[model samples]
Target chain A: MSERILSVLVEDKPGVLARVALTISRRGFNINSLSVGPTNIEGRSKMTIVTELESVEQVKKQLNKLVNVIKIVELDPDNTIESEVLLMKVSINKETQTSVIEKANLSGAKSVDVGQDYAVFELTGTSKELIKFEKLLKPYGIIEMIRGGRIAIQTKL
Target chain B: MTKEKLSGAELIVRTLEHLNVSTVFGVPGGAILPAYDPLYDSPIRHILARHEQGAGHMAEGYAQATGDVGVVIATSGPGATNLITSLNNALMDSTPLLAITGQVASDFIGNDAFQEAYTVGLTISATKHNYLITNAEEIPQVLLEAKHIATTGRPGPVLVDIPKDILNEKANWTEPKLEDLPGYKPTLEANPKMIQQAVELIKNAKKPILYVGGGIIHSKANKELFELSTKYNIPVVTTLMGRGAFPDGNELCIGMPGMHGNYTATTSIQKSDLLIALGVRFDDRVTANPKFFAQKAKVIHADIDPAEIGKVREPEVPIVGDAKSVINGLIEKLGDSEIDTNSWLNEIKDMKENYPLNYNQEEKGPLKVPYVLEELQKMSEEDSIVVSGVGQHQMWISLHWKFKSPNTWLNSGGLGTMGYALPAAIGAKAAFPDKQILALDGDGCFQMTCQELITASTENIPLKIVVFNNGNHGMVRQWQKIFYNHRFSASELTHHTPDYVALAEAMGATGLRMVEKSDVKRVFEEMFKTNDRPVLVDCVVDPDDMVFPMVKAGGSNDEVILNEDDLKNI
Candidate 1:
């Protein structure tokens, strides 16, 4: 029930991601969302993951024990910036287009692409704002929606 | 050094030789044949085990018997899978072992072509770390790294899986690099402030027990541990894996404390106010239920592995370092001083005298395992090595045998693998060729790996095998009888069980079966006189007999049932 965010650094190698994911799954926890990208250092990558933890400390301890994992830092909300990007194609037409556009504009949504009958609106904001924007667009009948899971950064100051 | 053109297989053997591996135990298969081709030319002795599983255990036995890391080799598919149990066994006990398994050709790896399997994936969880060689040239560095990892920092098993074609690929021989790894450094020095805190706690503790473990043996911290115990006038109780770490014959040696432990040891842990747990993992058998285990005791755990710290019961004082280094630090900090806890010592002495590890010596029944093992212990050499398989008989041997030195007692403490002793005895005998060796196994357990008697006889390993023949899996039967309303299941070995004596004889070993308690001493004495060849003693014991001072599953260690009357109330 406790969603914890973790930043994991590991040596870049084939199946290294599988290993990290495997370790979590074997311990009976599924990743809510995971993103992997190269870190500042060569031959190393950073993993941003969100998972429901029964005991965050226990999971951290286990993760720390994994041979591939170089380091694991659990982000503290007070010092962290958490956000997400979402793209939704709402079922819109001439009748509700203006109101939908006005609502989208108010909610900080930008029209990225448009087709004859559907429009793709991109919204980048904190997860709370993004979720609220999606909810507001749901009444207009969302055809398809995709979310880029939360990415976080801990501030030094 | 100039690079010599060689195949990856040749380089693997050369790397092992360069690392000074004296022996490799394994069975052959198609995928590993490339490595085996060059192995014959290598100086390392190859122990051709009957089964890959037996080979794995033999390597473990060699590692445990000697301080050196043991090497195991096997092919892919079934061969690699066979080593899983032994890998887990070594991992749990923290024995240093390196297992090299072959994989199918790279293209055929996932296709399941000719003995292909997920070798690395299968054993990753069981090993400290594992490698699947993607590049043929990196084999030496990986093996060297594997060796370094296997033998260092709370030693455990490590596996390296190499594809078959990669072994045939041309590779240049190069000297192995020796340097510090970037991230995988283990803390070897105890924090000075933490050492001071532990010293303070030790001084304050009135009723203290030194809970020693197998890590003492691995770290060679026995002398320091003894110094710590004797100086502070603390009693010592060893776990099953820790049994031989401390001298069992010492007056301060309370005995093993856990499931099937002696009454004095288990009760002492319960009553003590302080438990100085050295290199012990606080296994479930020792604690039974952590919530109720040593409720009044403040624990001080010192180990090289941080993961082991608080993995079970949280230690009030946690010292992360090599056990020897930590003990040395403690000895330096604490100084040579004996605390005045005469009242505590007297209370322990009373407890020891009140609850003796008793069995009916004069009972009119078949041979009893306790009496036989006790007799064996007395008859065996003072420096003999005793290995055991899992079962009720394993409990009996552990309870009865008195080890005078370190590395003299061996058992499958963690994984509890049945049929571990025969091959392990063979390997240990190989390690200490001049010493007397014995494998105490039960009928059910002995049957599991008794085929290794062939290796013992052929290799001229004069290991004396003792079978506690209770006509069933005694531990399982006991569990069923006690907890399951005597619901007899598949535990009975009465069906399809071959005569152990005849089986041993068929394998070129001198076999004898003793049925009466009167013959126990005479048989042990006469048989143990000369271990010129392998000997099997089938001691038919009372099937109804049960191990005492057993902590029920999930039960409090303090609430151990010592007798049938104690069980009846529960």
Candidate 2:
């Protein structure tokens, strides 16, 4: 299956997210990732969902049936602005600490905290950049990793 | 409008009154007691159902019969959960039903308090739209919105779950502004370009069929459908849900199409050159195998919901709009461009004559379900409402009964929920007190929601219920007989205890049992004559009797099994 990103505008109400997610996942579409945030429009929230779907058109039509969903737009990876925040703690010793710090600096990661054997770095970038940076940290023995799901917006409209 | 302090329960009752909801079917419980208190003093009459499921189905029945929004109320937890079946039934059928359920106290909602359940979470997927009301002030707006959503475009069940505390809390009552829901606007008018395309297809098609669905009844477009069918001399085949949408007695009407559908209707649809599908989702029951369904037909599908337009089979011309408006669009565009289809009509007439829906009733043997239905149809008024339970009896009624008007036939079409007939009949009777409401049920189906008979008896709602007691799940047994080498495993009712006649008497309804074939007409006549109270006639029919004109599940619609000869050939 191919991954498709959908930006849905819905009413900012309790259980509205559940309704949308349930409507999608119930139809057997696996949700790869989803992020929700408040929109500039009052009483409305925007949800960026990354799903592995055979036909996103069918899902859009189903989503449109929900009373809370105001709008749905597919985001083209080529013309869409997508980003997420990643917080990673990497294991480091005296010998590898310098190299790890240098690599993290090159990847635009800020050292949020430093311990004797561990370094906590925070980064914000496109999912592609984050994946690349994650690979860099993997060599340093990642202690833990957490990334906010991707949020996208169509750049043109 | 003057603002007045009102409790959430009061607000609900007042809003219902404001919306012209004269009747509600429900059973009160702990959480919903406050609403009942207000209801006791309101103009809206509440019919107390024995169970919440019965209430929901009754509401659905009322909606289907009258083309009006039906309301059902129940308390939280078990009460709300029980309504799930009915909610799903309404959802599948596109019935305009509003289910108002009481929730646990707002403070104890997540605590899993006594008799508390996550009603909204449970019903979110089942309902068209649902609201959980915790704030007293939100009651007016949410209720109004719930009603609007349930009754408007692509009508379906909408639920409003009110917390007990919210129901008790006081709030100022004023007519809240109906929010403009940008997400929920249904396309009601057909695109002009698409209408022109449909017209062109109609002009070119030699063999065309108006494949009608329940949407016609929901949209009150029976007149439009009739006009179009007659004006074009096109034959019509209605789905189970579209039973009475077109008069069954009309020459152009070729009965139902699908599994257990008429031979002529099924074959005609399979062989048609063009199908002008209106308000119908080519359901699997209608088009057994989508790939092979209407192999020759170029489909022009019209429906209010965009999702259903291409959910099954992609049409050559998909028109997303209300059935009535779409038909009007087609009529406006056609503008006296009628070509001749006499040859096609003659072919259909030959098909109808050669393959008519029939059943054998031996004079010396036990009564048959079809015979009972035939007699009932003959004895009942033309405007009488016929509701059936699922299985053998349902198929028999759909095939045998000659429906002459829209909204006169009601059953659990989509979900095929058994035990739907009695309560739905009660609901229909309540809505149209002047019309005769008949509940035709199978022995297996009748027992599921038979408890609702008490509600009908107590509420003084008279209904004529005919239980086709064949001593088994007739449809299942038929399948076993055909597919499983006659191995009737758990299909037969062991002993068939609780004697339906005695049970009927215990429930305060007149009980009658007919075992002989000759007594079919007399028993029906006697039952119809007694109209003061609910009457339950247990018809003892041959258990081996099966519904014919059967298209084996997942089989092609063209391969209909007409009788023993057809089965032997297969």
Candidate 3:
């Protein structure tokens, strides 16, 4: 079963998340990545849930049973432009500055320096791009990598 | 009518009335004097308990019986701390209870306040939710939210810590809307595919056993469980917490299976081809040796709590949803599967016939605990509610009594609270006034909260209490006798006990004492004859009498002592 992302909109309230998470969990769905944030609309929250589903029909049926869910949309990565933010601190010294800066610029990343020891870079792109960027920067002595687990949004109308 | 400026006490009385709370059980203190003043004039009746713990238990009993959130109030500091045990009791038992407590004052908070603690933080894990109201304006919403959280979703206790200053502050607050909580949600439906998979497994398996737990009662899925078990012809085994979910006398019943489970039930679980675990957590006590337990079967665990699944033993098909909804779905998908377990059923029957829950004292001992439980079982209706205090009496009641309905047996299952019986009985009686509510209490446990007889009388709730007066905590003493070389440390409770009959009379309730073994039956008969007030039956039983068919704690279920011979043989 390949992984699928489920974006659900629900009434923002106490116990609503517990209800939704419990429902999905009770259904035996192994949720991979879950991000909950307030939506653009007031008193509403959007929960982006990524889980491995045995079948699409099963996901739909399970999602339909949940109460207080205003809408649920299944996103397709093949056609939709999906992006996730990646934050990392790479050790930048005289020995590996060239390769690290080249990789960061290639990945459309901006470097923010705090001290002399290391430089923190913020990168936002597809999961594939982030992976590629991480591999390129590995030779430059990467200190820490924190990937804010995937949050997706459709690009086209 | 003159609308005078009301004190914090007045607002409390009015708020309680607005919430339609008819009774509040508590012990007043210096910190709560302000609130107590208005309680005198309020329509809500107040039941003063001997201890703060009793008050908390009374509230728990009320909630469990009525299916409404039970309300308990206490003073600051020690008063609030005393409620911890009962709060933990409610948490473990999944009883919906609302405990309101007074704090020292807002100004005094965090300054090593005399009677102030971070009650909200202290009770965070114990309570389903908690609030510390510093502002009087937030009182109405805090109360509303407390109730909503207490009674909703795997019901548990919720605490509202009111600062003394806030209670004293006057505010014109209307009933606030129960705002939507952002973080809390409870699931009510099962995944259809998992339900189908579970159904398919159930349909295909020849030797299927249904292991139900307390969640069935919590979710009110007893009817659904019964129907599914009956339709599929599956034998049922229950956890200690799951007692009373199915009629004990039912042919398909395999009895309670756990650390202290009967040999037949445990063996059946071991040999079954498919174990259908419904609403059970499969606690270590229930599945001592998980690898050996249900080893021959494909496990299907259905529970409302998501975290419970695979926490102990992994299931082949895990159904996470409300027990009622999932069971209903399973019933729907169970199409024309004439699954038969006749051979398996006969095996269980033979085991039961060979090794029954029996205590050999045919010669008539001074006290017969089993005989008392048997009489209570016979006299009460199938739906009559039974609550028990922790100890040998609890296990004895579990083994000997035949419960025909779910939620009828209320005890401190997970927590095993000793003083649980009297207060829980008070709560149960308050919840179901028309139903016969009985508390199978031990002498040690009964004395802990026996003072609630006053509350029982004052509230006019007819609660029946059967004290297995064995003069000790029978369970604790039994351990000392069996494993501790009979050293008899603090186990011997030889303190002066009150003249229970006289005590009951003092509390304005009826009490009967059975000194002679032959008079036990007559006393029970006479006790049941009265309906005007509550009754307490003080039957002096033998302290040496142990709840046999005992599996040593942390021992495998198969290693149970059925009789004295079994103990000697082992």
What is the C-alpha lDDT profile of model 2 across B82-185, one tens digit per residue? 99999999999999999999998999989989989999999999999999987899888888889899999999999999999999999999886788887888
Q: Tell me the TM-score of model 3.
A: 0.78
Clashes counted in candidate 2 amount to: 0
Q: What is the lDDT of candidate 3?
A: 0.79
Per-residue lDDT tens digits for candidate 1, residues B1-570, read 666888989999999999999889999899999999999998899989988889999999899899789999999999999989999999988989999999998888788687878888877778888999987899999999998889988899999999998999988887889666654777888899888988888888888889989889999888888887777788999888887778876778898988788888988899888888888889998888889988999989998888788878888999888889888888898886567777888888898888888888665677778888777777778899999999788888778888777888888999999999888988898889998888888888888888899988887888898888888889999999999999979888872268877887899888887888778877787677757789998888888899997889898987889987788978
Relative to the unseen true structure, what is the C-alpha lDDT of residue B480 in candidate 2, on a scale of 0 to 100? 93
Q: Could you tell me how far off, in angstroms, the CA of residue A122 lies in candidate 3 after the best superposition?
A: 18
Q: In candidate 2, which residue pairs get closer than 3 Å at backbone N, Cα or C atoms, i.e. clash?
A: none
RMSD of each: 2.2, 1.8, 6.5
Better of 1 and 3 by lDDT: 1
TM-scores for every predicted model? 0.95, 0.97, 0.78
- Model 1 residue runs over 4 Å out of place are A1-4, A28-33, A51-54, A93-102, A116-119, A141-146, B336-338
The most accurate candidate by lDDT is: 2
Q: Please provide, for model 3 over A57-105, each residue's C-alpha lDDT reduced to its tens digit, 9 standing for 90 to 100.
A: 4555445434356677888766566668888898877766766777787
Task: Tell me the TM-score of model 2.
Answer: 0.97
Best by DockQ: 2
Error of 2 at B48 (Å): 1.0
Kindly list the per-residue Cα lDDT of model 1 for residues A1-157, writing each as its tens digit.
Answer: 3788898888887767777777777776667778888878999988888877655566676677666778889887678887788999988898888888889988889988767678889999887898899889889889999988778889964
Candidate 3's C-alpha runs over 4 A off are A1-157, B1-19, B381-383, B495-499, B502-511, B531-533
